[model samples]
Target: MADWDDGYWWSADGLRLHYRDYPGEGLPILCIPGLTRNARDFADVADRLKGRHRLILIELRGRGESAYAKDPMSYVPLTYLQDVQLLIDELKLDRFIMFGTSLGGMITALLATSNAGRLAGALINDVGPVIDPAGMARIRSYVGKSISYPTWLHAARGIAETQTSNFPDFGLHDWLAMAKRLCRLTPAGRIVYDYDMAIAEPFRVPGGGEPGVDMWPVLNALKDIPTLLVRGGLSDLLKPDTAKRMLETLPQMEEVVIGRVGHTPTLSEPPCIAGIDRLLARIAAAG
Candidate 1:
C-alpha cells in the first residue's frame, strides 16, 4: 500500500496551502481538483496510479484543510495560479505533469501558457476555454450557499438527487464516499463541508465582468507540449462542438470521451482509467 502524507506550503499572500503526497518512484503528477472540491476527490485515482507516478494533490486555498483567505476576493483564478507556483517552488520540483478537473483545468491552461517550461505535460478533464453559460449559472446558484443536512444519509441523498446530472451511475457507497470527502465533523458535532463557502461569493454577484479573459491564447501556448483532454460524453459545460474546436486548434492534442458521464469523468471508472493509461503511455513515449 502506498502511504499518503500531508504537508503545507506557504503562499505569497501568507496562506498555508494544504496538500497530500502519495509516494511513488517515478515522475510527479500534480492533481488539481474541481471547483468546491478538495484533494480527497482524487483518492481512488491516486491509489490506481501510485506505482507509476507520485501523485501530489493540492487543496487550493479556501478549500480542504487549507486556510481561507481573509480577503474573499483572493479566491479567483489568478490567485490560484500564483499559489500553484508557490507550491512548485516549495516542492523544489523542476517540472511536473498536471491533471486538472474543471476549475483546476482552467489553472492548468493558465500555467501552460504563462510558464510552459515548468510543465512536463497536461491532462485536462472536462473543461475548456469556452464554458456554457447555463452551466456556469447553475454552479453559481449553489457555490456559496451553506449546506445543512440532518444526517449523512440525508446529505448523500441530496447529492444523489442534485448531482444526478453529473453522476448518474453513482451508488449508495459512492454517495457516502463523496459525503465523507466533502464534509468534516467539528468539535460541536456539526458536519460541514471542508471548503469555506464564502470563497464562491464573487461568482454569484451579477457581472458579465471581463468575459473570463480569453484562454485561447493560453491554450495556444501548450502547442508543443504533450496534452490529453478528457471530456464526458454527456457534459453540458464542455460541449462536443467546443471539444472539437479545441482539437482543431491544438492539432497535437489527444482526447477521449467517457460515455454516460457528464461534466467530469471521475477517473476511477474503468473506461476513464483506460483512457488515462493510454494518455500516460503517450507521455512516457514522447519523453
Candidate 2:
C-alpha cells in the first residue's frame, strides 16, 4: 500500500489549499472533492488506485485544512478553476485526468471548457449541466451548519444513520473513517470539521431561485475531450434522463450507474471502480 503524503499549495489569493498525494509512476489523476468535502473523502478510492496512478486529492478552498477565502463570493467555480490550475503548475504536471464529485464535477466541466489542453480526460461523478434544485436545497441545509456530538463514535453513528440509505452495506469502519475525515479534535477535545460556515452563505443567499447558469454550452464545449459520467442509481441530483442527454451530446463519453446509491456514488464501490478502470483503460489505449 502507498502511504499518503500531505501538503498544501497557496492559491493566487493566498489561501492555503490542502491536498494529499498517493504516489505512483503512471498518469497523474487529480481528484476534486464535492462542496464542503475534502481530500479525505477519496481515501478509500485512492488506496485502491495507488499502484496504477498517482492520486492527487485536493481540499478545495473553505473545506478540509484549506484556508477559507476572506471574500466568500470567491468560493464560486471560477475561483476553484484557478486553484486547480495553480496546483497543477506547482506540481509541474503538464497534463492530468480529473475525477470530480458533485461540485467538483462542475469545476471539472468549467476546466474542460476553459483549459482542455491541460486535461487528458475527466470523470464526473453524479453531476451534469442541469442541477436539481431539491438536491441543492438539501445540500444547503448542511453545508455550514454546526453539529455537536459528544464523541467521535457518536458522530460516526450519526453520519452512518443519515447516510444509511446511500450506503446500506457500509460497516462501522466506514463510518469511523468518515467521521475522522469530517471532524477534527480541538484542543479541548471537541470534534469539529474544518470549514468556514460562511462558505455556505452564497448558496443559501441565492436560494434555489435561479437555475444558476446554463451549463449545456459548457458541456458541449468539451465534446472532444474524453469524459466519463458516473451516476448513483438512486440519485435525485443527477437524473438518469440527464445522463442519457449527456451521452447523446457527447457520443464518445462513457457512463455508469452504481446501484442502491443516491446523490453521488463514491468511486470506491466495486461497480463504480470497475467503470473507472475501464475509462482509464480506454485512455491508455488511445495514448
Candidate 3:
C-alpha cells in the first residue's frame, strides 16, 4: 500500500521541485521542513493526524528529491518564499494551514505577509524574528561538513554525538531512527547526508551570519490570523526573550514550550501535538 502519492512542481525559474501528498479529509495542511531537512521529518506528525486533514509535505529546492538551484544564491529565504508561492499556485491551493520548522518558519513569516488572507492558520516551530548567534554558529559548524560512514550504526552514532545536546532524552532507538531518516544509503554502500553540499553556500556568504532581514514587519503581518509558536524549551535558536517579544506583538498567537528539546521540537512530542490540536481547532472554527 502506498503511504503517500508523489507530486512535483516547477519553480518560477524552471527547476523541478518535489513534495509528498498525503490524502485525507478537511482542509489541507502543508508541512515545510527545516534547513537541510526533508519532508520525512513530518512523517510521524502526519501519521498521527492522518485521515482528519489532507497533508502536503514539501521538499525545498536543493533538498530531498528537488532539483538543486543552478545559482546557489537562490537558496535564500526570499527565493524559498517565492518557490512556496509557486507551489501554492500550481496546486491551486486557495487556502491551507501551514506548519513550518526553522528556515521554514521564516518562510511562513513572509508568506503570512503576502498570503495572510489565504492562510487558515500557521504553526512556527522553534524560529523567530531574531535567531541566536550561538545557534547559528552551531548550525554553521555542521552544515556541509565532510561526513561519510561505513555503516548505519556508525552514522547513527555520529548523529547522536553531535545532536545529543539538542535532544537529551533521545535513546539509542530514537537516534538510530533519526539517522535512517537523515542519512541515505548510497548504492556504493556509503551513508551520506541527503541534501546537496552546494546548499550551504548561502550561509558562507559575507554578512550571512548576521540577521540582515527585518522580520518584524513580516511577523506583524500575522496579525488577525490564529498562529501557533512551538518552541523547544531549551532551544538556542529561538530565545525565550524573543518569543516573549513575539507574543507581545502578536497577542493572538498561541505558544507552547517543549522541555529539554533544543533548536526545534519534533511534532511527535506531547506538547507539540497538543499545540497543533489547539491551532487546528482554531482553524476549523474559523471556517
Candidate 4:
C-alpha cells in the first residue's frame, strides 16, 4: 500500500475539508474526484503513482471526511474552485499536475482557464465542457436519494446495477472493491454512500429539478495548457462530438477513449496511465 497522511483544512465558510496527501520526491498530482465521490476514488491510482510524484486526493465539502456545508448551495463548481485554491495556498504549492474526473474534470477546466500558468499539466477523465443533457439527468436522478442497504453484499450489488453499464467488464470483485470506496458501513450494520445528500441542492429546483451550468468559457480558457482528456465509449455525459470540439478549441490537447465504460475511468487503467505519462512528460520537458 502507498503511504499517505490524512489531511484537513478549512473551506472559506469555516467548514473543515479532508484530503489524502501522498508525499513524494518530484512534482505533485492533485486529484479532484467526481461530484458526490470521496477521496478514496483515487486510492488505486495514488498507490501506483506515489513513487513518481506527490499525490494529493481531495474530498470536497460534504464528501469523505470533509465537513458538510450548512448551506447546500455551496456545492457549485466555482465554489469548489475556491476550496481548491485554498488547499493549494495552504499547502504552499507553486505548481502541480491536475487529475480530475467527472465534475472534478470540469473544475480542472475552470482552473486551467483561471490560472493555467499554475499547472504543470492536466488530465480530465471522462468529462468535457459541454456535458450531455441526458447524462446530467441521469446523475440528478440518483444523487440526492436516501438509499441504504442491509448488507455489504446488497450494497455491492446495488453499485453493480448502478454502474455496470458503464463498466461492462466489472465482475464481482470489481463491484466489491468499488463498494468499499463508495459506501460507508454504519455502526448499525447498514451501508450508505459517503456523501451528504444535501450537496444536491443546486440541481433540485422548485419545479424543474436540477439545472446545469454552462462551462464553454472555462474550456476555451485552457488554450495554452497541455491537457489530456479521456472519454468512455458508452458515456452519455460527454459525447464524442463534444470531445472533438474540445480538441478543436484547445489545439494543444490530446485524448484517450476507454472501451465499455460510461461516465469515467479509473486512473490505473493502462490507457489512463499512458495519458498521464504523456502529460507528465510534457511537464518535464517544459522545465
Candidate 5:
C-alpha cells in the first residue's frame, strides 16, 4: 500500500477540507476527482506513483472527510476552483501536474483559462468542453438520491445492477472494489453514498445542470501546456466528436480511450497508465 498522510486545509468559508498527501520528490501530481467522488478515487494512482512523485488527492467539499457546505449553492465549479486554489496556496505549490476527472476536468479547464502558467501538465480524463445531454440526464437521475444497503455485498450488487451498461466488463469483484471507493460504511452499519446529498440542489434548478457556458475557450487555454486526454470507448459524456474537437483545439495533446467503459476511466487501465506515464515524462523533460 502507498504511504500517505491525511491532510486538511480550511476553505475560505471556514469549512475544513481534506486530502491524501503522498509525499515524494520532484513536481507533485494534484488529482481532482469526479463530482460525488473523493480522494479514494485516486488510490490506485497513488499506489503506482508513490515515492516517485508526490500525489495530492483532493476531497472537494462535501465529499470524503471534507466539511460539507452549509449552503448547497456553493457546489458550483467556480466555487470548487476557489477551494482548490486555497489548497494550492496552502501548500505553496508553484507548479504541479493536474489530473482531473469528470467535474474535476471542468475545473481544470477553468484553471487553464484563468492561470495557465501554474500548470506543468494536465491529464483530463473522460470529459470535454461539451457534455452530452444523455450523460447529463443519466447523472442527474441518480446523483441526489439517498439510498443505502445493508451490507457491502448488497451495495456492490446494487451498483452492479444499475450500472451494468456503463461497465460491461465489471465482475462482482470489480463492483465491490468500486463500491468501496464510492460508498462508506456508516455507524449504523449501513453502506451509503459518501457525499452530501444536498450537493445536487443546484442540478434541480432549471438550467442548472452542466454549465450552459461555452467551454471551448476555456479548453483552448491549454494549447501551450502539455496535456493528455483519456476517454472511455463507451462513454456517453465525452462523445467521439467532442474528443476530436478537443484534439483540434490542442493538436499536440495525447489521447487514449479505454474500451468497454462509460463516462469515466479509473486511470488504472493499462492504456491510461501508459498515456499518463508518457505525459509525465514529457513534462519532466521540459523542465
Candidate 6:
C-alpha cells in the first residue's frame, strides 16, 4: 500500500502545485517546508502521525513535483502565503493545525494574525520575529545556486560537508536520507537541487531579502491559541534571546529546544516529537 496519495492543486497564478496526503481522522496537520524544501521534509512527521491525524505535506511552487512559476518574482513570501491559503480553501479546511518550518514558520505567523479563528494549533520551527543577520547572510550565500552531482554518494557527501555543523549527530546514512529528500535524479542520471534556481531572483531586490514583517504582532496573535515553539540550540537563524522573547510574549506557550542542532531541527528528534505530541494533545483536549 502506498504511504501517501499524491495530491495536486492550482496556484492563483495558474501554476500547478503538489502535496503528500497521508490520510487519517480528526483535525488535519498542514505541514509546510522551508524556502528551498518540499513535501519530503515532512516524511518523518507523516510516518509518526499517519494513522493518527490527517497530514497534508505541501510542496510550494518551484519545489519538488510542483510546477515552476512563470514569473520568478511570484516566488516571494506573499505569493507563498497566498498559495497556502488557496490550498486551505481547496481542501475546505474548517480548522487545522500548522506545522511550519523556517519560511513556512513565517507563513504560520502571518496566518495566525489573519486567520486566527481557523487555527487549531501551531508549531513554529526554528524561527522568530527577528532573523539573525548571520543566518540571513548564510542563506543568501547558497540559495538558487545551480549544482548537480553525478551520483547519489557524491550528493550525500556534498550535503554532509555543508550541513555537518548544523547536524553534528547525523551519520552517512542520515545524510543519504536527507540528500534523497533535498535532491532529485535527472533523466541523465545526475542529482540536483529540487527547487527552481530562479526562486532566488527576489532576493536581489533591495529590502526584499528579509521577511521584513514586524513579527511581534504576528506572534502576539498566537497568544490565545495553543502554540508550540521549537528552536535548535545552536541555531544561527533564531537566537536564544529571540526565543526567550517569544516565550515572554506568550508565557503560556510550550517550548522545545533541541541541543546541538543549528538552523532547524527535524521533527524526528525525540524532544521535538514530544513537543508536537503535547501540542496535539492540548488541541484534542480543547476540542
Stretches of candidate 4 exceeding 4 Å from the true structure: 206-214
Per-residue lDDT over 113-210 for candidate 2, one digit per residue giving the tens place of the 0 to 100 score: 76657777889999998777777667766777777677898889988877777777778998887788777787787777667777776775643322
Candidate 5 residue lDDT tens string, 1-287: 64999999999999999999999886899999999899989999998998889999999999999999999999888899899988988898888889999999988887767666788889999999888989989889999899999999999999998789889999999999999999999999999999999999999888675655688878888898789999999998999999998998996698899999887899999999999899989998888
TM-score, candidate 4, is: 0.94
Score candidate 2 by TM-score against the native.
0.92
**Cand. 5 TM to true fold:** 0.97
TM-score of each: 0.94, 0.92, 0.97, 0.94, 0.97, 0.97
For candidate 1, the per-residue lDDT at 100 reads 94
Regions more than 4 Å wrong, model 3: 209-212
CA lDDT scores, all candidates in order: 0.83, 0.81, 0.88, 0.85, 0.90, 0.90
Task: Please give the range of 10 consecutive residues that has the lowest summed lDDT in model 3.
Answer: 204-213
Q: Which scores better on TM-score, 2 or 4?
A: 4
> Number of backbone collisions per candidate, in order?
0, 0, 0, 2, 0, 0
Better of 3 and 5 by lDDT: 5
Q: lDDT of candidate 6? A: 0.90
Off by over 4 Å in 6: none
- Reference-based lDDT, residue 33, model 6: 96
Cα lDDT of model 6 by residue, 1-287, tens digit: 87999999998889999999999987999999998999999999999899899999999999999999999988887788889999998899999999999999998888777676889899999999999989988888889999999998999999998888899999989899999989999999999999999989988887665666788977888887788989999899999898899999986588899998997898889999888889999989878
Candidate 1 or 6, higher TM-score?
A: 6
RMSD of every prediction: 1.9, 2.2, 1.3, 2.0, 1.2, 1.1
